[model samples]
Target: MRQIWHVGKTVLGMLLRHPITGTSIIPLLPDGRIVLVRRRDNGLWALPGGMVDWGEDIPTTVLRELKEETGLELVQLGRLVGVYSAAERDPRVHSICVVVEAQVQGKMQVVDTLEIIEVKDFLPSELPLEELSHDHGQQLKDYLNGMTTLA
Candidate 1:
């Protein structure tokens, strides 16, 4: 017998239930404030990101999702913050998110309001970690711990 798993609208063989691939960015302003989006679904603040589509590489997904969610096109991509794969990181599904450090060069706007209610910037020490969605607070914690140098 084969095991089965459900992910979003698709079903996968249990053994093939590889964690979904996603990318998120800790978009920083030149002044050192980090960008975050407020999720419309649950009203929790989160880094801008989304699931990686089939046939897309992680870097492409990172850029695309950043643009889609935050309208940031001129960004300087930095080092990988870390890869988060805790089984309970997300409430919706088991997944892996590649967290990257980035610096956005432009005005911040809420482009994908359906998923993001607003965009805001905050100093790392001033982040409302308790209000972040999905394991984003932990991800940000990893960044602040000097896991990677932000650009």
Candidate 2:
């Protein structure tokens, strides 16, 4: 199964015309927990984010994804943690994620059940890194290490 999946991913990557762009937002709560969503397709926990539509700016992309996946509108789009372009980060396509660490205000709810299976808060220390999708675990690690300052 793993080998088949890898082969499929490789084929998909090769067929793509260009790398896709996306945005990820890590929402930090007052008690120090960050919001995460479990992807319905792969069952992997990930930061809230999705693809950037054509002509959409990075901030707009991040805000839209955050609201779509996590049911939270951006109270403040904190800061860009970094851009991740590692070839291995996404399996379906050559992708880039503009990772943002932010303080968001909203009542937690599962909005897009088709895409997101679960939503919850977790401390960076307690996050199940092994089960995190893409390079999200590493992104969170960078955030925890103070790689980006919150605005």
Candidate 3:
């Protein structure tokens, strides 16, 4: 998990340094699963999100990113989970991430745009180790451990 940690720190740094404008989702499924995506950039699974265009609202941004990245329509959105940053999470630059709770209800599909490599729904325990972002992994672990509820 050394690489994962480094990557997490990198992402954190990018967000801090550049103040990136991005949106992400914690898409909860009907059966209480979460929607996760494996991106082509690093082949790791992360919450669905993307950079926002100028003047876009956070909720709209989250909805757009989810559909563009994972082809899911969200039903509800809740509080901001948290913002993360580090020196090594992203290689390009610091990415300012806005993470929020999203209730998703729709047929799932991989966007043909090719940003995402794959999509999956799994119990927190069943998450593929290869696809997890080291930092977000902790959040998932916390939820799985019953330390936090999807608000």
Candidate 4:
């Protein structure tokens, strides 16, 4: 009765009040190339990343997402590139993205076929910046310019 209604309200509030947290990985290879994934939904290139799963820390999320999206293993988790919190950064939901530069190794493959269509490495000079999905263009630019951002 009253207790049940209060509990339901609390749950709903919790769900709506917090933005989902995610990690966007700039997977840097030893050859100085970066890995980017082609998104299935929009056919646009994007940084390799995904939302942080429950019970996972940020570093763990970065590693898991990099492997899942790009088939690359993290050699070292580099600096935080930025923390993007604009409500419209992700079209599917309100999410806060922690972008990191990761030194990674391993064969590049398309592991998540459902979300990604292609996985490819690009030299810094050859990145398709204008066609990147979401806010990834800005993210990559910040990383390339040797700037850490909070936006």
- Local accuracy of candidate 1 as per-residue lDDT tens digits, 18-126: 8887878899888999989999989989999999999999878878888877777646788799888876787767788888998786778888878989888998889
Among the numbered candidates, top TM-score falls to: 4
Write down the TM-score of every candidate.
Answer: 0.85, 0.85, 0.75, 0.89
The sequence of per-residue lDDT tens digits that candidate 4 reaches over residues 52-128 is 99899999999888888888999999999999999888866678999999999999999889999999999999999
lDDT of each: 0.82, 0.83, 0.72, 0.92
Candidate 1 segments whose C-alpha is farther than 4 A from its true place? 1-16, 148-151
Candidate 1 displacement at residue 78 in angstroms: 0.8
What does the lDDT read for residue 32 in candidate 3? 83
Report residue 45 deviation for candidate 2 (angstroms).
Answer: 1.0
**Whole-model lDDT, model 1:** 0.82
* Candidate 2 lDDT, 1-151, residue by residue in tens: 9889889877876788678988888898877789999999899899999999999998888778888888876777777798888767787777887888778878777888889988899977889876789888888888878796321
- Poorest stretch of ten by lDDT in candidate 2: 142-151
Relative to the true structure, candidate 3 has a C-alpha RMSD (angstroms) of 5.7
The per-prediction CA RMSD against the true structure, in angstroms, equals 4.8, 3.5, 5.7, 6.0
Q: Evaluate model 3: give its lDDT.
A: 0.72
Model 4's alpha-carbon lDDT is 0.92
Residue-pair clashes per prediction, in order, are 1, 0, 21, 0
Deviation from native of the Cα of residue 45 in model 3, angstroms? 1.6
lDDT score, candidate 4, position 140: 96
